[model samples]
Target: MSLSDCRILELPRISDPRGNLTFIESDNHIPFGIDRVYYLYDVPGGAERGGHAHKQLHQLIIAASGSFSVMLDDGTERRTFFLNRSNYGLYICPMIWRELHDFSSGSVCMVLASRKYEEEDYYRDYAEFQEAAEKRG
Candidate 1:
């Protein structure tokens, strides 16, 4: 598709003095749907997570506690995003290689996914991911 097709995902925010809250709903906040929730935490500075690509999963990632960045690549194009606020999220589409890096200390990244954990869904090898993405075109 186009770059616009893989842009950031807009999420709903609720503010209160007690605290703020954000929600991600299946087929609602997300387009495809949702089935999984995972969080990454305690990553040191200059460290990274997620160096793979998914076959058919969509995700909405948020900085629930602190801040982090997501670097997305689609073989031909790339984008870097900073998620610092709890009320915001980054929606990542499938077939895109993503690297979640640059985590500030105490950062908690919550990911809402559209697919369950399937071993076949992951492309752990970069060379394999590139070949598969090219084949899809």
Candidate 2:
């Protein structure tokens, strides 16, 4: 749940004269099994996303196009990462407070989640997240 627990996964890049390709598969580059894939788009400046934390699900986030950044906080520790390439990803463990920001124009962020959509699995407030994380200790 700390910044130290988060990791950057360098995905394999297949270079071609025309273009480059990258991919992430379950039981491979991703630490957790992938069950869902979603992308964020059309984010204007001064807007933010992912102001929440999951209780159990893990996520592998990629900047599929353009660039973006994520601010990670685990109640005590904080770290920020700029994701600007398609061949890289950020692996976020459970109980980490994450906020996605600074999206470049036409940027698209893809997230591979370990679990399907479950409202109960989400902690939408920092105070609530802290309480749950504390209880887990």
Candidate 3:
């Protein structure tokens, strides 16, 4: 899919004077069914992660604790999203390259994936990802 397919989603939030709560339901708040869930935390300063693309996986990435930036590339164009709110998330479509960087200390990145982890589904090489994206087009 193209870069236009990617979007930001606002999750349900319940505001309380004591604290706030955010929740997501499969195929309700997200476009796809949830098959796997993962999170990244305690990332050291200046470290980067997620330098790859998935062939058939859809992901909803949220900043559950602190802040971080998600750089997205769809073979032709590139964009960056800064995530710091628990009520917001970035929806990444398949066949796009993504990188997570500039993670603040104690940042927790929660990822809701549409499918289980499959090594074969990942394209880690930028050139290979571009070629694969071209083939998909």
Candidate 4:
């Protein structure tokens, strides 16, 4: 509903002399159950993605490698989050418009979604998203 509703979550980290490890479990490390998992990679410089909002979907976005920023707008407020760590993730709620941009080379953006992909659940147009957000509010 608002930018305040979005939060950065810290995942479990296991440090070892060999290598550091991070793990995430559905509804354990994230607020919602994970029904889908995907990642974005090989993004060219200055390119952008995710210019839409979901009606009832929730997602946890993490930077598994390199770095990137997510711009979030919740109808009334806007905020930007820089994700560069595999042990941290950004939790996005429904009705919030999100855009992913400013990706560094070799950046891997991983997303854990609450539900499987459905075209009807997406609000791709900003104007329509604003109207839907207003109605929900």
Maximum-lDDT candidate: 3
What is each predicted model's overall lDDT from 0 to 1? Answer: 0.83, 0.90, 0.96, 0.94
TM-score of each: 0.91, 0.96, 0.98, 0.98
> Given candidate 4, what's the lDDT at residue 63?
98
The positional error of residue 59 in candidate 4, measured at the CA in angstroms, is 0.4
Q: What are the per-residue Cα lDDT tens digits for candidate 1 across 4-110? A: 46766667878799976777668877786777889998898898899998888888888888888888888677889999988778878888899998899899999
Sort the candidates on TM-score, descending order.
3, 4, 2, 1
TM-score of 4: 0.98
By the TM-score metric, which is better: model 1 or model 3? 3
lDDT of 2 by residue, 1-137 (tens): 56688989999899999999887779887788988999999899778999999989899999999999999988778899999989999999999999999999899999999999999999998999988777876
How many residue pairs clash (N, CA or C atoms closer than 3 angstroms) in each of the candidate models, in the order given?
Answer: 0, 0, 0, 0
By lDDT, the candidates rank as 3, 4, 2, 1
Q: Which 10-residue window in model 4 sums to the lowest lDDT?
A: 128-137
* Candidate 4 Cα misplacement greater than 4 A, ranges: none
Against the true structure, candidate 1 reaches a TM-score of 0.91
